[model samples]
Target: MNRRRFLQSSAALSLLTAADFAPWQAISAFARELDDFVRGPAVKDHPLRQVSKHVWMIFSPDGFPTPENQGMMCNITFVDTAEGLVVVDSGTSVQIGEMAIRQIRKAFNKPVIAIINTHYHGDHWLGNHAYVDAYGDSLPLYAHPGTIQAIQGVQGNMWRTLMEQWTNQATIGTRVVPPRLPLKNGDELKFGDVTLRMHHFGVVHTPYDLCVEVLEDGVTLIGDVAMDHRIANMDDGSYLGTFKAYDSLEKMGSRIWLPGHGEPGAGVLKWNRRLFEGIYQPCEQAIKDGLALEETKARVLKDPRVSSQARDTKGFETNIGKYVSLAYLEAEAAGF
Candidate 1:
């Protein structure tokens, strides 16, 4: 049996032979210790790698959570500004955030001054707990108003539960700590040597998805608006809105587009654009032709961009059909 269960069994046996009140007091103290042990061990530190002049990242190659990965499914980016280190997206859990903090201390040895939650997704922002713990409640945590609201409401606990389920309780002790400051599009914050500009295109990835441009580094931290090789979950996103966001992002003239899920590169937005078009355009055409959902799925699968990316893209085979259906439904609604 596990340590907690064994302790419980021993406690029960001692209770059967209780001749004194001291044993009961000891069991109560032991119960408090058991409560402290609910969460699994802290995640091992992942090495931090520099991505730009000011940005360093703890890159998690995996895109989905598993017991083995312990919910480290998103990239934790640290921008080293003269003021201090600014965390782009904290990570997936308190353990993951603590692990990232360990790496940050080893590499940069700077305190985290601020944290920006790109969207309301737990994988991107649930690690806020660790930063707040290390720094204090006074540390600035920024996000779009909608993101802050969602996390403050049901989305906060909902994601905490989901991550726990997905990671087989590996993330058991994480608590929801939503962003406090709300940032809108075109807002700029100066952090000593670094200047960050926030961009929000309505309902692209989510209604309040915030993309932060590190102006000095010529890189934009594109939250889930696009990804490198994996298709984004579009349950709250739009094909048309994503395209519009891409148009606006390209005009900003940032050279490197870093994503929350994959490696940073110039082609991050382009790669997602091509893949999204491959998934959505054919469905749009199918809707115009009065084609059924299955037929649209076939057309999307046969598209050159989709077929070529199928082998390399994570969740493409399993998620493409659902994406095609969403695209077809969107196209039909747009036609109305």
Candidate 2:
């Protein structure tokens, strides 16, 4: 049979040609099924929610690291400018990035002028593959210098390990793509119609972290420094610096806030502050009482005030203890 007939006859088209279309002929129907199984709702259900005229957000609820969400436990924000588009944080995998691109196409056909990663985490920047696939090397990714260093160094390896462990076939085509452009504190970037004010709160969520404030939209993408419903993950940061970062964010006076995770994007600074203080004070008292890490963890978890902040997610339970232990360590290292 001819290649087309063989394809129509349901032969494995791999035997036909080395052409890209051959692969599609073989797997198109099955691929659609698999894609549906892995990916979340189409543009209709998870459509980008508008924060402002220029600012839009896609919020991903906390859940297992499936292909559907691509470990995008955090929210992704995009800004439309007069020139093109600016993505606040890419998704967790190549597929997620492609989905971001599709969503962008659904709204605007402009080129992505920049993708600014608030930090080095893969969930925030790994979806770079989609942009890279579309624009190739011309796509300029911006982040703090520390972000590049960490991803190029140890944290990059850590993310790979975690994705492999948690995701199913979701992470199959995704790999780490670190940012290329290094941004500094107080740097002003004018891209189309919006100006980005990149603010770095010293040694907060990550040693190299930043929050992008959209000067035109009056919205600030505060990265992971603040979260809603879930207690902040203390796996890669400091208790003292977080409080300081919160102080800085609260003073930004932006009309709207976008967190790495959460809904509505408003009052994030206040909610994170309350959770941070609630967890910190008890942690300090435990350290002052000469409690060990384990004891401090126990005290923090049992504390009626902060216990409510620990959230439960699919395949994972919020371990408030880790936050407590990290807080104790940060306090001890700073001699506070």
Candidate 3:
């Protein structure tokens, strides 16, 4: 069948399979079902929530599945300074972005002089238009050059697919607004007393994955790089690269980690890195042993390291299975 027909068929089959499973069966099921859509509803309580003295986290309950439960959350930190405000990743939607702006205004009257996009993912950058469109071109937005390309490349498809999947609304056409300044690795942005160092690890989670480290606060807002110990999404073809990025973060030990999803914590970098190495390495090794796919999966599932995190293992297993299939294809290509 043609590509379009195949995608349609696959989508239908997936929907059917999901219907058979329990509603809210697992985060994996929810994510797969909502893969094409932007997560969460708009939250509108301003007056920024203070995560730290110098760091204020504007919580946008946008991507959360439930209105009361804050799941797919995004955070923006503000540094108290005379220069201007430094905002981190914008949430998934226009409403979320606007809400965050209102909160930022309450905390500091100064203009948001700069914004650092952690990556080009829609949830992170889609709300950017809301900021620029409101503040005019005065405020500069920074991201890796790869981020600019990815955003521009997926603009049309992102608008169409997101509307169809999330809101169940169809669009005739759509346009994407790009960020202002393209950032490079080691780029330093300063606002009054706060200084943020941008680090670009090429092609990790995404082609332009960027991490923002607040020197004074000692907090690092890692886009989607060091996420919670759930299944890592690799639909964008950066599975191996993502694992490598996780390794790098482990080495750069930090006190606090602000991930894209879940609550912020300390020492999560070590936990996340260990999980990737323990899980991915053995799985890759099992494939090399010429084990059948099912057998390999069963062996990995029963392994002590795997069973420890098995409660959150469903999504990991699903993603790893796909990775295994892809690895097999690569081996075949190499005439293995």
Candidate 4:
């Protein structure tokens, strides 16, 4: 099922218990169980559901990585075009990426013409190894320039190293393959039957974040810019950039939206604004008054509009702290 139906269904979270996990434990659970997630069970082939005739999205469950849920905490989107296949954001590792590609081949005969990396996050692009190995490195991969530069530099290597340690040894041969194509904002192209319009906003979710629009189907493939139900990590995210991305999406007026994480829909953008604003006003005020990091975090946690959905069952040190810390840093840097 697509994100819309999956999230709307009462059983969407049947297996996951959304308790607060330590940042490392919740977000990097995949690294901890890399072996089990790759070789343990039927972890690879989750389910790939159709968003449109030309679009299919693999919706991951909502929660930090865990053995029970595996490391499929992020969604993968693949599109079928007239000429070939187009993929957006590979999975976290070689195994997960392989499973996604296997599922893609099961449905069509098209050779993948392009793979798009929405940002610099390893989970979104490290799966590039699988596609490169299968289709050959000549297969054109697309991403923002900053994303390409980061992956080709030491920053990418550090993220890769961290992934290997977190997944135990499961990430062993998963090379960090940078995208071959640098896509500019508003670049439009046609692949078979679908028409693609690219969108870029500076330093919202990351230095290089790209969203795509399928003009043919009124569908938008937005990366990590928008999230629903849960609080998104803002350590590298910008409070103002997030709102700018939302405004861009609103202008596009697409009925279908596939998020990098969380369930897909227009609602994702709507709630993103609410969450950021709730944290920003409180955090901004604290920073203006010369409150310390800990004090700012405390103020954000007390504001339920932002923290209520993301609060853990027993810990005051919630994922909300990640947002608070990031927002506070941005405020200080901007001289709020």
Candidate 2 C-alpha error for residue 154, in Å:
3.1
* Model 3 lDDT on a 0 to 1 scale: 0.62
lDDT of 4 by residue, 1-336 (tens): 532234334232431344433354543454434423333233558778988878888887754444445456678898888899889988777777888888888888778888999888887888887899899989898998888998889757776666655665455456678887899799987886888888998878886789988888888998887766656666677898888778877988899778888777767787778778888878789978989989887787677765664453222246666667778888787782
TM-score of each: 0.90, 0.82, 0.73, 0.81
Tens digits of per-residue lDDT for model 3, 186-251: 888777787788877777666778888777877778877766655545445354676667667656
Residue 228, candidate 4: how far off, in angstroms?
Answer: 2.3
lDDT for each of the candidates?
A: 0.89, 0.73, 0.62, 0.75
Worst 10 residues of 4 by lDDT: 7-16
Clashes of each: 0, 0, 3, 4
Which scores better on lDDT, 1 or 2? Answer: 1
Q: Could you arrange the candidates by lDDT from highest to lowest?
A: 1, 4, 2, 3
Task: Report RMSD (Å) for each prediction in the order shown.
Answer: 3.9, 7.1, 11.6, 12.5
Which candidate has the top score in lDDT?
A: 1
User: Candidate 2: minimum summed lDDT over ten consecutive residues — where?
Assistant: 36-45
lDDT tens digits, residues 1-336, model 1?
Answer: 654457667775675568454666777775655544667668987888888899988998998898999998899888899889999999889999989888888887679999999999999998998899899999999999999999999999999989988988788668788999989999998999999999999989888899999999899999899998887999999999999999999998989998988888999999999999998899888988989999889889999988988899998878887888889998899889
Off by over 4 Å in 1: 1-36
Superposition error at 33 for model 1 (Å): 9.2
